[model samples]
Target: MILAKKKQRDFHQLSTPWNVVFNLFAGIFAFLCVFPFLFVVIISLTDEGTLAREGYRLIPSEWSFEAYKYVFQTGDTLLRSYGVTIFVTVVGTIISLLFIAFYSYAISRKSFKYRNFFSFFAFFTMLFNGGLVPTYIVVTQLLGLKDTIWSLILPLAVNAFYIMILRTFYSTSVPDAIIESGKIDGAGEFGTFIRLVLPLSLPGLATIALFSTLGYWNDWFNALLYIDNPNLVPLQSMLMRIETNLQFILQNSQNSSLGLEALRNMPQDTSRMAMVVLATGPIIFAYPFFQRYFIQGLTVGAVKE
Candidate 1:
């Protein structure tokens, strides 16, 4: 009893000063991570004249909603592009996750006859490619996926690095005993994969899902290459077009003495800040959901039986 009470007392000395120092360091680091977003939000709200005069600040001299208002002016076009972006992000992430998981699992199986060949096939693409022109031909001429939503998805569905990551994940995290147990239960290949393998592989799946979601969300190059129809352009592409048009208008407005300064004093700098916030806000929230699995995925293979 005396030893037990003494051990309890030893643990209650506030640990050490290092704990305080580490907490302080972490608090500062966290603030630094969040500061940029807060700064952008502030800049977006700053009055154009005040912003130009005083520059960016934690506390602006004046505030206005002009930047957000400018962004939302074309409501119908904004909503349509948002729909396209949402569809592409959701469907594309799902497709990429499925293909990646399936391919990785198949190749990870020791019983797979062509595991070496399939592994080589995925790895070889990491070092070499068919080039842009050939890929364009395949996408546009062969696949006939141009201007369709599938164009956004199919091109990015198979990533060599992602395949390798998940394949390694499967080999290390899933013990062979699990597979034997599934077989003993009379589960077929697909059934075992869906019911047993997948549940055990959530960490890897969520990690890949987060990556694929971000890739699809930020993909404007795909839209630029494949989508000619304005209606099909994703949100990032629409924002790029808006910036291009804004530049054009600003340049042409320069011909008139009061043109750039007029037009309700449009906030160009602040508008760009607003664009960043809008484009990134939804996706920023997605990270928290995947963070638990992402950490687990990264730390996989650290231990062995």
Candidate 2:
């Protein structure tokens, strides 16, 4: 009884300090990650004149919705961009997940004859690619996808790294016995994959979906390269235009009679922060839904037998 008590004491002594240290580190890390975003939110609500006079503050001297007012002064364009971004993100994510999951599942199956060949082909893409100029020519000239939504979706539909990760997850997480059972039950190949395999791979699929959603939502370069129509502009591209126009007006403030008046009314600083808030706010809400699956998918994929 005495020895048992001493052992318990030793464990408690060791665990207590380690637990304290771990919590301390985690708390600090969480604060570091969250503080920048909090700062942005605070600045977005801060009065522009007060911000200019005092610089950034965690708690502002005054609050104003003027930045948001300026942003939505022409609400139609902002609303249209939101519609475009939402459509692209949703459609792009669905298409990407379908192609990626199907391709990854095919190569993960041992019975598939060309699995090794196809796996190598997918992996080979990671090592090399056609130059950007050639890709642009193919996308624009040959395919004639330029100035269309397909240009945004098709080019980024499949990422080599995501394919490899999903393949690894399938290899490790999916049981051969289950697949065999589906076959023994007289299920067809497509039926088995659709009903059994896909259902079993929800965590992996959700993880990849989150990645694709973020990629599609955050993409501006694709629009810049392929789209010329303002009506087709996504939120990021619209924000980019606002940023550039603001810069131009500020830089040439001394060159024109109207420059000073433009600068006076621009909402230059707070509006930039407001744009960031607008662009990122909805996507932040999505992270919580995917958080569990993301952790599970990453952990399962990381440990390969």
Residue 185 local lDDT, model 2? 99
Look at candidate 1 and give me any clashing residue pairs: none
Instruction: Provide the RMSD of all predictions against the true structure, rounded to 1 decimal.
Output: 2.9, 3.5
- Model 1 residue runs over 4 Å out of place are 1-16, 261-264, 298-305
Q: What would the TM-scores of all predictions be?
A: 0.91, 0.89
Backbone clashes under 3 angstroms, per model: 0, 0
Compared to the true structure, candidate 2 yields what TM-score? 0.89
Candidate of highest lDDT: 2
> Where is model 2 more than 4 Å wrong at Cα?
1-28, 298-305
Of the candidates shown, which would achieve the greatest TM-score relative to the real structure? Answer: 1
TM-score between model 1 and native: 0.91
Write down the lDDT of every candidate, Cα atoms only: 0.90, 0.91
Residue-level lDDT for 16 in candidate 2: 75
Supply candidate 1's per-residue lDDT for 92: 88
